[model samples]
Target: MNFLYEKITFIFDPLHHFWEHEKLSRKISIMLVLFFVLSLLAIEAKRLGILTGPLFSFVPTNHFYAISAAFTVVLILEVISLVFTLPCSFSRSVGKQFEILSLILLRNAFKELSKFPEPLTFHGNQEAVLRILSDGFGALLVFGLLGCYYLVQTKAAEKAMRPTDLYAFVAAKKGIALTLLGIFIYMGLHSLTATLAGREHTDFLHQFYTVLILTDILLVLISQCFQPSFYAVFRNSGFALSTLIIRIALAAPPYYNVLLGLAAAIFAILLTLTSSRLFGKK
Candidate 1:
């Protein structure tokens, strides 16, 4: 019975500890590969104007639809994640904390996504902003749970792990938190900016966008005192950068664009450093 109990804990430990034993370069490289492939599809869709929905493929339409579809897809994935994660989270032998916790997490997330301010006004947007926020809310909750899981995993490790490996567990939990937080900010910002611009945003929209993003990034960098994981999380993914590129390629602006690009680059680099360090790479 004791042996069975220990084995169950190992499954969770291994997931968190894998980050420590696994090499940094390899993990990032793999993540990047997945990033690149997904990015390529996104870029290609934009280039070919296929992102606006295949049924509307023949007609040249708008960007809002594309954003909506993408955001919807992301939300669906989180919902699916909840289905798998709930059992792992709350269903305790007697108490079932994971299952209960998971339900609360999912509910809060959905509420954020679907529920907007009262006197709900669509500033000419179809529904993308609300969709993104609702799904985003759930994702954040799940991420919070992930942090909890990591911490629990750490305690589990203490039971069977070397004394020295304890710090490794802490590091991994912190790393995951920082990394996920950054992603949350980046995507949330992206959705907000685009929503503000709407479909009929005039010329110099990118310039305004560049300023907003740069300011946000700079603020985060300064606030965090340049923490590596903090920087790495927000700054890690180049998707937002890609979105900016697509806009610029559509003739947004290049000179001022570079200024904004600099901010994004700094954000990605710093956050990656933070995450890598937290993963025990430091």
Candidate 2:
């Protein structure tokens, strides 16, 4: 167990250290933005023959592509934020995941827009129109639901614990965060290598959520050590359900994905509100 603990810490130390520095975090954010902008410019230039071939040729030249890229970066940052926030508040961390999923749906909607027929008419391309309508409206609905979640979440009070128990809980959560960071790094490298090798990449979102479900179950077990109330367990378990919904969404068609994902968020919010009223009333 000691060796395993040290290995986990070693894998996650950089992420742990990165969040400790506000300046470093800001610098990294700026660098990601700059990289995205430069990449878009490079891709556009290559498409126009101002740059050489074999660079981002797999990517198409479209404004939607830029939007997708930017959102992809945001999704990665949000996942990191979720890991950091989990140690502090599990509900809030789950909310961050909902936010990430909403952005992903929005990103896919933009991609659908890019496929719109030239001259853009409702005639003869009804399928594309329906896709855009479904994705766009679905994203809007999810975003609205997310706002409701925030309001409900604000009403949920934090559970008090003995200082020693709180310390142990936080430490355990941090260890889980480190493990997630390791998974993120490994998935990224796996995706990059697969892309370079001209092979189909793994569904990273699915994999991440699978790990997350197990992590949340572990967290629930750990919370038992602190003599958590019934509501605490229910809320944590609800979060696991939310993560499972997201994993399922990844394999679903766009329209169904949006509906299922939105339902999951709503369910989670309802659970939180119920827990607050029944057990967290002050």
Candidate 3:
């Protein structure tokens, strides 16, 4: 228990102690949410086709764009997303990561039961994962750029660029590291699901989940620029506003298209609130 406690503390220590209670509270709240969502997923596992249709359409599976054009679009999206999202505290920053991960995990489980009703084809899953990796790299780039931008923006950051700013510099570095760890965990989980489950032979769970994750990465990137501004609004009594936007964007007429919508609105709201506080005051 002591070892586990140390591990947990270390994972969270990068965040300030002022945020300790908030993080623990959020962890519990998210756990409850995980339970409810997994329950829904277990039920939806019986109806797979509807679930996978959305994921397939979300990814340009055929690879139509030129490599350069494709790369540019991804780069732009990541930069825009991170430009808006990076300012919210580390714990707040990762909310969208949880949201997207939750959605993909559930969606993939459903895809497993429906699409490959016959034999498992796990290698097929790699296609979606590959696209997500491409996007994730774009996200890493954006986060990298934003970290530098924020470092320069900080008073301590701008003061000297000295050895002592090293603490703040390290804080920014930890943020980047945490974000990367999330991506690695996502990939590892995707692979593990296919390999450990009998579906390893026939499952495309990895593929669909990967594509969805790219969208998740984008959402988090966007939060970097605006999370603070938006949260101020939320705490001021904008209860349903954020949820409404997310729901509207996610409601893909026929189904929610991962790449085409605001799949992670909560982060957007907090991000917007945070950015406004910093940049919009009178």
Task: Say which candidate scores most in TM-score.
Answer: 2
TM-score of each: 0.23, 0.82, 0.25
Q: Each prediction's Cα lDDT score?
A: 0.37, 0.75, 0.39
Candidate 3 residue 243 C-alpha distance from true site, Å: 2.8
lDDT, residue 135, model 1: 38
Which regions in candidate 2 have their CA more than 4 angstroms from the true location? Answer: 1-17, 20-29, 49-57, 61-63, 114-125
Candidate 1: stretches off by over 4 Å? 1-20, 28-34, 45-126, 142-282
* Candidate 3 stretches greater than 4 Å from native: 1-98, 105-113, 120-231, 234-240, 248-255, 263-274, 277-282
After superposition on all C-alphas, the RMSD of every candidate to the true structure, in Å, is: 18.8, 3.5, 16.2
Better of 1 and 2 by lDDT: 2
Model 3, 1-282: lDDT tens digits are 345444544664654343335776577557655654554553354345444443233222211222222332233233323322333343333333334333432343333333332344566666555444434443343344334433333421111234543344344434554564455456556755655442434323233334334434443444333333443333322322333333343343222333322334334444444544554442
Ranking by lDDT: 2, 3, 1
Please provide, for model 1 over 39-114, each residue's C-alpha lDDT reduced to its tens digit, 9 standing for 90 to 100: 5466556657566754433322332333333433344333223222211211111012222223433333343333
Question: What is the TM-score ranking, best to worst?
Answer: 2, 3, 1
> Model 1: what TM-score?
0.23
